[model samples]
Target: MTSVAVKARVTGRVQGVAFRTWARAEAVRHGLSGWIRNEPDGSVRALLMGPAASVADMVRRMGRGPGAASVKDVLTERTDPEPGVSGFRIVG
Candidate 1:
């Protein structure tokens, strides 16, 4: 399987919601490694690296976010996976 890294920014009603928590859980479930965090601009940003298929699924889930989150947009940029990401996390 090809490993890929994605940098994503989810906008709208994402702040103060369980978006990051949901994202972390989803990433772990997909066996991906990276981190999710809330941006100062009220968006949720994430860096995900894993199998291409799994990363795709994670991105889809991030587009929807948690039930309480109103995700208006999800912008993702595909890139090369980095080395040494132990597990999925919620970063500052």
Candidate 2:
């Protein structure tokens, strides 16, 4: 199976809404490896690398994040996979 690495920027009521935690859990559930963090601009950013189907599923979930997060938009793009990410995590 082919895999892909993607960078996603989630906007709107995302920050301070447990978005990171939700994202991490979701990513792990989908067997993805990546890091999720809050951006200084009040958006949530994530780098996901895993099976193409899983990554795409994760992106879709991000759009409806945690219920508490009113996701307005999501920006996704391809990227080179990073090394050494054991699982999904919320980065500071």
**How high is the CA lDDT of each candidate model?**
0.89, 0.92
Provide the RMSD of all predictions against the true structure, rounded to 1 decimal: 0.9, 0.7
Tens digit per residue, CA lDDT, model 1, 1-92 = 98889999999999888888888988898899999888889998999999899999988888888999999999999876667877999987
Q: Which candidate is the best by TM-score?
A: 2
Which 10 consecutive residues of model 2 have the lowest summed lDDT? 83-92
Clashes in model 2: which pairs?
A: none
For model 2, residues 1-92, the per-residue Cα lDDT tens digits are 89999999999999888999889888888999989999999998999999999999999999999978899999999999998877888896
Model 2, residue 45: C-alpha shift (Å): 0.5
Candidate 2 TM-score, C-alpha based: 0.96
For all candidates, the clash counts are 0, 0
Worst 10 residues of 1 by lDDT: 77-86
